[model samples]
Target: MAAIALSVSTVKPLGDRVFIKVSESEEKTTGGIFLPDSAKEKPQVGEIVAVGPGKRHDNGTIHTIDVAIGDKVLYSKYAGTDIKLGTEEYVLLSEKDILAIVS
Candidate 1:
């Protein structure tokens, strides 16, 4: 058996997929109450880390994705596959899973 090292730079999303680094969840409530780790919600916001070329159209043309790397976006709550690299968290999802680009 062989061992391969996977790093963030080596990850590339294929075909309309986007790789995002998840943002940290809120540690406290708006009311100034501290929340435990288990009570923290999975954040829907993330920054785009890697993106695929684009989706192929019926005519063989590529329909480019709207978001770009470094763009902060909001995605579906349970949309993408969760990934953990070292101590950071990421998600790989289709373009459709993204709801909007945050300013």
Candidate 2:
């Protein structure tokens, strides 16, 4: 799908899901030639723009997610569902798919 660059404020994730703004892949090589879309590698790292409240438990308490909004995270290569709002690209994935906080 074509990329959409929308304001991130419009999204809200629920039930341990997160809204991540995926990092852009390389645009040019050392020779300064721009890479085609087919040559660009999908980025595995992204910044958390929005987060869910947390996963609710059977006991009625909500367990917090490890990552917070604004955190840069590494996730499974094929984890999230890709989405576009306006002109920005985003990924919607469950907390379990996040491998680590980039720090």
Candidate 3:
């Protein structure tokens, strides 16, 4: 059996979910002080690289997700599932995890 390599140019969530590439924060402070690896704060914002189709209601209606790909967004500090693409790390989260979309 051959292993398949998946190259995702656009990620689409199936339902009320979104895919995000979590941006790593700068390690050095503005004052030029380098924070230790353990002291670095977790990034709360990321760019939306992929989005789910929409949310399904009990009434059989679909509620569309607001965020689109390439949009920047803010999320909870502990939300999302971590994934690795090539050499980069990313996050897979539900639409509810997205707190706000930044301009």
The deviation in Å at residue 1 for candidate 3 is 8.1
lDDT of 1 at 80: 87
Alpha-carbon RMSD of each model: 0.9, 4.4, 1.9
TM-score, prediction 1 = 0.95
lDDT of 1 by residue, 11-63 (tens): 99999999999999999999999999999999999999999999999999999
Q: Pick the candidate with the highest TM-score.
A: 1
Compute the lDDT of residue 7 as modeled in candidate 1. 74
Candidate 3 weakest lDDT stretch, 10 residues: 4-13
lDDT for 65 (candidate 2): 95
Q: Look at candidate 1 and tell me the lDDT of residue 81.
A: 100
Candidate 1: which stretches are off by over 4 Å?
none
lDDT of each: 0.97, 0.91, 0.85
Q: Look at candidate 1 and give me any clashing residue pairs.
A: none
Predicted structure 2, TM vs. truth: 0.84
- Return the clash pairs for model 2, or none: 4-87, 4-88, 5-87, 5-88, 6-88
Poorest stretch of ten by lDDT in candidate 2:
3-12
Could you give candidate 3's per-residue lDDT for residues 1-103 as a string of tens digits? 9986644564556889988888888789999999998999878889988888799999999999998889999999899887777977688899998899888
Q: Give each model a TM-score.
A: 0.95, 0.84, 0.85
RMSD of 3: 1.9
